[model samples]
Target: MKTYDAIVIGAGPGGYPCAIRLAQLKQKTLCIEKESPGGVCLNWGCIPSKALIGAAHLYHKAKDADSMGIRVGSVEVDPEKLQDWKEGIVKRLTGGVRGLLKGNGADLMMGSARITGPRQVEVTQADGTVETIEATKGIVIATGSNTIELPSFKFDGKQIIGAKEAVSLREIPKRLLVIGGGIIGLELGMVYQSFGSELTVVEALPDLLTGIDPECTKIVERRLLKRGATIHKNAKASGYERLADGSISVKIDQDGKQITANVDVVLVAIGMRPNSRELGLEQVGVKVDQRGFVPADKFCRTNVPSIYAVGDVSGVPMLAHKATKEGEIAAEVIAGHKAEKDWVAIPSAVFTDPEIATVGLSEAEAKEKGIEILVGKFPFSALGKAMAMNETEGFVKIIADKTTKQVLGVHMVGPEVSAMISEAALALEMAAFLEDVSLTVHPHPTLGEAFMEAAAHAMGSAIHILNR
Candidate 1:
């Protein structure tokens, strides 16, 4: 048995960072991964999808170049070349992650790891050989999550596909049916739409991006509609019939009426579930919830003192950044350092045409909690930079506590707002008052000013817009 101070199972964003931090603290660390070092985000989901989105964005821009006084005849997209480029990016990133693990003095073992016992791990190699690893101190579980598959529509890895398969699709479908209208659906929908596919989004929720601000989603819905994507909200998919030609007829019920639509491909982006199965958690003292999520305390410590869980296995807001932060905190706590996982903001970004970013509580969430709040908004249409760039599509909204005037949430939907959302997240994390954000001078002729302006509007001191 190989002994170590700390053993991290699943070298995902969460596990890797935890292992690295543990190594930095002068502890012997070992990280075991069934797949690649960088996890799903690096290998398939996040990075590859974003790369495709970038290519689609460039294609759309080139197609619209004629309107910008540049005469561009016909634009073309080569999915083969795009796939090659995306693969290159993925290889480089995963390679970098592998280097970091080695440099940090963490043992990178390629295999599936399970909690055989408290402070004990069993790694099953690809060759069907099992090796036992014992950690003297603790173990961190960051196995992450997998795409949810519905009963009626099982992913065959071909016709019925998930985000992973859709990323590298060679031929664009003439008609595509996206099963969910969440972040992944809309993002992939945009990509296919850019590739000249007639895309239709069918969501069971009343609105797209069910948890986000309704007003913000409205703008995206409008843009998607304008771009030729049909949305059917409050719709439930009944079943699908596969034709001899490989096309599918999808039966959907929207408020009692059964509507059938035919499409060349169906992409399921409903949601993801925790990958806590087969990790031998039950064999140990660690308790897993009904949905297969390992519950952990604030510092990511599981019921078992020597075992901890992070990322998707720990549940909600299954984002890479969240996992990374949790990994750091878990390591710090293990190293005898003062660390707390409590934070006011963990930002969520949607990579649609007009990207959506939200941090902290929305107006509805505040109202549901019976907290008195005030909201302010700044339209991108009024921003000089937005107009100049011809990318005016959405707005910035700020929600604050009515009593303390503390900024509660910042939601934005516009071009590249994903990059600008970190500012809002940082402010909310620091418990910054509205006045602090408003007083911070944001440079003129930029999208960032919209955030500051929104904060100013909350205080009724915005100079850009007249008093409403």
Candidate 2:
């Protein structure tokens, strides 16, 4: 049996970072992966999707540049060329991951791994050769998650599909019907919508992007509606049928009424389920929750001290950055350093049109907790930068404590709000008061000035906008 100090499974955003950090800590670390390095986030979920989104955004902007005084004869989209460019990016990033692991002194193993004992792992290589390895220190499980496929609408990888197929479509569908209205569904749906596909969204909840600020969601929803897309809220897609002409007829149940939508493709982006099964975790006495997530404490330790779990397999939020942070913390803990999952807040960004990003508590959440709060808002419509870009559609909102004037949350939905959110995250992490941000000088004619303005509005001293 081969022995090592630590073994990390699944070379994803979580696992690769943990392995690299452990090796840097001078531990004999081995990272095992059954698929290509960088996992789904780089290959399918995050990177590729963003590539498509960026391309679609550029195309959309070009088509509507007449108002900007830019006149072009014609515009066209070459799906094959776009896909080739996206694949090139994926190839470079995944290759870099491989090089980084080797450079960081982490052993890379290509195989499917299963824990056979408290410290023993059995790896089955591609050639059917099995090797048993022992981790003298610990084993970190970061298998991540997989897209949930509905039984009623199995993936054909053509007509009906999940996010993986959605991002790789060579030819844009003429009409697209999205089954869910969550982050994945809306983001991808809007991408295709920008490509001139007739888009229809079916959401089971009362509103789109549930759990997010409703005002922010409304702007995105309004944009879709203005673009000739159909949105059905409080609805469910029961099943789908394949027509003779190679089209999909989706059956939906909305408010006790049955309706049918015929389209070229149907995307079911309901959610992702943790990849926690068939890894021999049950046999080794590691507890997996009912939802298939591995529960870990502050130190990322499982109930069994020799085992640890991180990333999508560990819990909610299921974000890549969150997983990376947890991976580093776990590595530090295993390396004899004191580290825990201690953070004030995790910021979330939705890449929908006029992107929505939020950090810390929302106004509704604060009120639900019986906490008195003060709210401030500044619209992009009033900002010079947004007017210059001709993409003014959303606003920035700040929520703070009424008594202490401490900043509780910052939410934004506007142009490049995704990039502007890091400042809000830092403010929350440092427990900054509303005045802390309001008093700070921000450069003129920038989208970020909205944050400072919103903070001032919350404190009843806004310059650009009137206080409520």
What CA root-mean-square deviation does each model show from the true structure? 1.2, 0.8
TM-score of each: 0.98, 0.99
Worst 10 residues of 1 by lDDT: 459-468
TM-score of model 1 (CA atoms): 0.98
In model 2, which range of ten residues has the least summed lDDT? 67-76
Cα-based lDDT for every prediction: 0.91, 0.94
| Candidate 2 residue spans exceeding 4 A from truth | none
Return the lDDT, model 2, position 228. Answer: 94
> Candidate 1 regions off by >4 Å?
none
Give the clashing residue pairs of candidate 2, or none. Answer: none
Q: Candidate 2's error at 32, in angstroms?
A: 0.7
| lDDT, residue 290, model 1 | 94
Best by lDDT: 2
* lDDT by residue for model 1 (1-468), tens: 889999999888999999999999999999999999899999888999999998999899889888788878888888888899999999999999999999999999998887889988999999999999999888999999999999999999877999989998988889999999999999998999998999999999889988888998999899889988888999988899988887899999999899998999999999998999889889897999998899999989999998999998898889999999999999988888999788877999999988999999999999999999988899998899998888988999999999999988999999899999999999988999899999999988789999989988988999887645
lDDT of 1: 0.91
